[model samples]
Target: MKLTIVSRNPKSTKFPVTLELAGTASTIKTSDVNKALAAKFPKYYPDRQRLTTEDKKVLDLDKTLEEQGINEQSSIYFKDLGAQIGWRTVFMIEYAGPILIHPIFYYLSKFIYGSSFTHSPMQTVTYYMVMAHFFKRELETVFVHRFSHGTMPFRNVFKNSAHYWLLSGANLAFWVYGPWFAQGRAAAVRNDVWIYGSVAVWAWAELSNLITHITLRNLRPPGTRVRAIPYGYGFDLVSCPNYFFEFLAWTVVCFLTTSWSAFLFNIVATGQMYVWAVKKHKNYKKEFKDYPRNRTSMFPFIA
Candidate 1:
């Protein structure tokens, strides 16, 4: 096969270089081809390369050349995907923002909500919940979750961090503990009942979310890019049990706090999670013939 590598910088190489394969096209995996290219070029590592056809159809690294309809005479274009960041690092950065930002807003409430505003007991409870939620996420990022894709584009760290930092941290904390919300806490008896009841539900959601993450981590062993149908525990209820529980937790927060910011964040997160769940559910059906027929995405039968 003659492979062509398109440089991001025009001055880098002498244009696309032709490579001759040493083995039968049917036997060579797309990943093996990237290894050979990396060997000759030393710059385009397999993980950093985004291979595509002449017509711009992206190639799957997991499949063989024969499966992709490529032969000895076919030409493929290699695009260099800039700097990469570890998935763990991206997750850590994203979760860390919420942990720090939530506390900052809580402590600086006098400045943000003015000197007249008095802190409510519910505010203290909310502060603790926000801290615990992000801290647990940080712990999971470090030890529990196992990612199939080791790295992603480095630029994605900013985007991912912004979501957690802006919505879950700043928006959630600012409104829930603000003076406007303190006025609503006037119904102290009713508020206490809702807050305490929701705390129990939130605790259950958080624990279930952790369990689903562990189940997913076990599905793919370390150092392998294998995928399997997830079963048992929360998986029996929804395709993305983690998402369902996460949504449940946030929904509980929104109801307990009665804050528009919390409700907005929950809505945005649910929309994003539903999109991801739908994609994952579709992929499971496509990849595994034995995938559960009755399994929906994040929701039960309604989705």
Candidate 2:
């Protein structure tokens, strides 16, 4: 089939080009059209192309061209989404900062608190906890996460990096090892149960979060953008169990640290995660007619 691509973006000048695509209109996907265009226009990658009908109606990449009413010799508008970065690269950069920044503060505590400064048991444990948590995130970014979107706007990297580096890295590290860290140690010693309980919950939440990631990964086949209703593990209770578990883990950290900064970070993170979870839940219901009726957005039984 032959198709014509007209540039809708004012920044692009290469369009009004006709290209031959290999499948019948029924067999060719929107993604296929994007690929065909990308092959001819080197600057327009598949991830950076947005296809629309003559009426400017968006075409879903997961659906076939026929489903979207596109046919032989059809003209579609191509909007170039500028300046993209791979999803994996974004996660790596953001997670890598916390791993290094946390430790730098941990060691600098010696100088910050003077030579007599020593780590309280909670500080020592949290130092290791912070390291392990971020290291696991880095490993998962490489081995576990399967992103539905291949790339994001390149400029978002700074905003994303600042969120992780400033909140989780610098702000968290300073509070955990700062002067206020030892103020409650004597009381904490008397209540070992809180420490042990929080640690246990944190560990369980971390493991469950990983399980949710694996479940999500298994939902899509390799090299495809297929989506399905997720079930099992924590998914049965909520549309986004991963976010639930992530919030739980951070809440545990806040409880263990008993620091005002830790609590503030937890609140900020939870608010952000809740917004994302609600959007994902809405999408799931919209995309799947039979999406589970009992499931909440991120909380079980209570949204």
Q: Which residue pairs show backbone clashes in model 2?
A: none
lDDT of 1 by residue, 4-53 (tens): 45554467655577776676767778888788888887766777887887
Show model 2 residue runs off by greater than 4 Å: 22-24, 54-56, 72-74, 112-116, 183-190
TM-score of 1: 0.90
Candidate 2 lDDT by residue in tens digits, 60-92: 988898898888767899887888999999999
Highest-scoring model, TM-score: 2
What C-alpha lDDT, on a 0 to 100 scale, does residue 205 get in candidate 1?
A: 96
Which ranges of candidate 1 are over 4 A from the true structure? 1-14, 20-22, 183-191
Worst 10 residues of 1 by lDDT: 181-190
Clashes of each: 0, 0
| Backbone clashes counted, model 2 | 0
Q: What is the TM-score of each predicted model, taking all chains together?
A: 0.90, 0.91
